[model samples]
Target: MLAKRIQPMVSQARRLYVELMFQVMGRALQAVSEVDDAVKKETQALPAGFLFEMMVMPNGPRLIVEHTGLGRLHYHGASAPRPVDLSIQFKHIAHAFLVLSFQEKTAVAFANDRMLVDGDISYAVRMTRVLNRLESFILPKLIAERAVKEYPSNLHLPHKLISAVRIYLKVATNFVETVRA
Candidate 1:
């Protein structure tokens, strides 16, 4: 049980998203003023309409990072009113939660599908490109750090990798399609 809860920390998708969001945000903010300024400025256009609910599935907490035309980055539970522009789901957000401290590697995480955007690819991609530029150079140290930080929990061989097979067998106990495929 404990392992399951903590397992997402090593998820490829979650880790990737965490790295990517930071990277993209940092990239878009370049030349705007400083990193924070760019995060604030570029996100200002995020539409005063909807909330992005990024849910890390199967009991992992939801990380809701929403922006609006109103001029600020708001986390979940903010009293601010809204019907937001896009509330894309990012399953297993905890993977992306840690170690987005840098500008460039953050972008890489997103590109890797650790952060899957669902609403509007155009806006998401545009944001991604902007963030990519701010990353002066993708350093090996950063990559190494991410790998070290994410590696221990990747229980890829059995549970995760073979989940499909096990679940199929369980569900298909009486079906022929289970073996046919």
Candidate 2:
């Protein structure tokens, strides 16, 4: 009986955690596009107004990022008002939680058939590269190494530290603006 009751609570908590992770990731991507040259260059490769979405199937948390002109990105919250250029949908919330929590690398999740991708494969690849770069900026080296396919060897400590600080500051400011709006 206790196991049955606890299961629901655990599932709900996982859902909430996934939702929060999506939000933070959206903000972090936005920060990365604005502050990281490599990310900006990647975004520039995407067409202006391009929208990319990542979500869990059956109405779970969603994140949408748009490639605004001028090599910038905008986080459009959990919904897409317009059709997205690329959409990555996890088969279940558990799969999404696993990937978001760094228990699974994205390629591993894809290999395990944990998610589905819609739209251009090339665009998805580009977005993955951007996400990897963004992760390197925001996550600790140890965690980032696990989250990304490979930690960038060229990113020396000083550069990583400075970029991380700037990106985090942008994320905070974006969060405040989001709360206000």
What are the models' TM-scores?
0.39, 0.97
Candidate 1's residue-wise lDDT over 1-181, tens digit each? 9989877765766556654454333222322212234345555666654455444444343434455344444444312254434443444555446434443254455655656676776667544433332232222334534433232233333533343244234333423432475
lDDT of each: 0.43, 0.90
lDDT of 2 by residue, 36-131 (tens): 888888789889999999999978899999999877999999989799989999999999988889989888888899999899989898999998
Which residue runs does candidate 2 get wrong by more than 4 Å?
none
